[model samples]
Target: MTAYAVGQLRNVQMNDGIVDYLHGIDATLAPFGGRFIIHGGTRETLEGSPADDLIVIAFPSKAAARAWYVSPAYQVLVPLRLQGAEGDIYLMEGVGSEHRATDILDVG
Candidate 1:
């Protein structure tokens, strides 16, 4: 089954080096089968607090997600993301077509 990794980043203070970091990071993700499903979009907080940015990326699989997270190439960008923002990142197993009905049934 495919999986999707969602990142919720809150940038307290953005510096000028972010562009360079993103350029390199984007290329690095391709090795591990990563795709940018959502980069930055308009968001509204329906409930709790609000965040600065909402980043959502999708991976080919859970293993791909894990590999991309810990890969040395991507690891170098960690400091950039940390210094640029503070947020939570999560990975969730994607529901395939087979499970679509189950998801609806469960919701019902």
Candidate 2:
């Protein structure tokens, strides 16, 4: 199933390390078929206040997402991101195309 790596980042420090991380991330993602679906940009707030930046990267599958996150190429950049941003990054499996809202009722 398709999966995503989502990040809710705040207190970002735009330093050289962060810039280097940005420069190197794409090369690492290419091999694993990961692409950014959302990167902190303009948004219309309809509810509670949200100051943190939201980032979402979609991958072919959970395994692919996990692999890309821990791969040597990407791991080297992890520290830079951690040093630059305070946030949480997590992987989540996606629902199939035929999924329905009522599907939650089936969850045990």
Candidate 3:
């Protein structure tokens, strides 16, 4: 199944810290079959204010995603992500195919 990780980032305050985290995060996601599907782009506001950044990543399976996230290497980056940005993150699984609610959460 395909899993996705989605994030909405606002008030990003730590520049250098996030940069470093991303460097390590990119490398960590590779072996787990993770890829960025959305790398944050512009959008027209329709209602409430939206965050400046939105990101989505796909993974082969929910287990693969979970494994990557809990791995020692990536776990260290969690705090950086939290302290650097104010946002919400969620995992959803695709349906009918490899993508299901279970699959979406599996992405790292």
Q: After superposition, how far is residue 100 of candidate 3 from its true place, in Å?
A: 13
Better of 1 and 3 by lDDT: 3
Which residue runs does candidate 1 get wrong by more than 4 Å? 44-49, 100-108
Candidate 2 stretches with Cα past 4 Å from truth are none
**Could you give candidate 1's per-residue lDDT for residues 18-92 as a string of tens digits?**
665677788878998888888876666799887557677788899999889889998888887776678888888
lDDT of 2: 0.93
Q: Please rank every candidate by lDDT, starting with the best.
A: 2, 3, 1
Question: How high is each candidate's TM-score?
Answer: 0.79, 0.94, 0.76
C-alpha lDDT values of all predictions: 0.78, 0.93, 0.80
Clashing pairs in 2: none
lDDT of 3 by residue, 34-91 (tens): 8999985668789997656888889988888877778898889888887688888777
Candidate 2 per-residue lDDT over residues 33-107, each given as its tens digit: 999999867989999999789999999999999999999999999999988899889999999999999998996
lDDT of 1: 0.78
In candidate 1, what residue range of length 10 has the lowest lDDT sum? 11-20
RMSD of each: 3.4, 1.1, 6.1
**Candidate 1 — which pairs collide?**
none
